[model samples]
Target: TLLEGVEEKIEDITNKLYVVLAALIKGNRANCSNFAQSARLNWLVNRLQSQQASSGALEVLHSVLVDSPEVLNMITEAHILAIIGLLDRNGRDPKVLDVLCSLCVNNGVAVRANQNLICENILQRRDLLLQTALVDHVTW
Candidate 1:
């Protein structure tokens, strides 16, 4: 059966799906966070970290979170902070900085309005990013 075939090839299917989903997210063609998360992006990140595929995985995650213009209003403050923290820790990657800037400029208002406490909690982090020499290279 077609479903059986798909199930049997879950890993291949998921990898292909990730490619498509990553493209969509990078192109800003999808606005649904649920769809993005459904792709197991976080799981992919963990897998990448485990396998030392950090660069590729971070690239996909950055595209989904930053390049995707679809602002996920439902994302929790903690979640946003977590992404920021990850970027801060591994932000030496150029792509990570790009995504961080987008979140700061594009999603900043919604984040501040919805989760003032969380926003405040990460103020130092934000400020540090701003102070970084790389900050100038990130536009919007």
Candidate 2:
């Protein structure tokens, strides 16, 4: 089962499972996109809501979002919003927030991201504040 490996109590095994899943999603983005947009993706996202196994699920999600922008289109706005909400809840992991911020570069995000406080977080990065602000504004 897809959840079996991820549900392992062993940390190394769980990380390895995430690596394999991320590689699979990257290797065949089209098929993965089909899967990512299905109910299965919802199940995977629910994994992120869990406290123990969320990091592995988050790693897979971050990899997919970074490696396959088209998959983002396959994901619904509500799911994306949920991811952003997760970012706020799990703000300790900067990579997750970075992935969410990267989505701001996508089209139609201005509307979907209205409720997300992406700007406040971006402002915290002095190096990216100006560049991101300009880019986000221009892209909008």
Q: Per-candidate TM vs. native?
A: 0.46, 0.55
After superposing all C-alphas onto the true structure, candidate 2 shows an RMSD in angstroms of 9.8
Residues 57-128, candidate 2, lDDT per residue (tens digit)? 776776666565665555666666566556556654675665575566544454255234455544554343
Superposed by TM-score, candidate 1 places the C-alpha of residue 56 at a distance from the truth, in angstroms, of 2.2
Candidate 2 TM-score versus the reference: 0.55
Best by TM-score: 2
For model 1 the local lDDT of residue 97 reads 56
Clashes of 2: 0
Instruction: Judging by lDDT against the true structure, name the best candidate.
Output: 2
Give each model's whole-structure lDDT.
0.53, 0.60
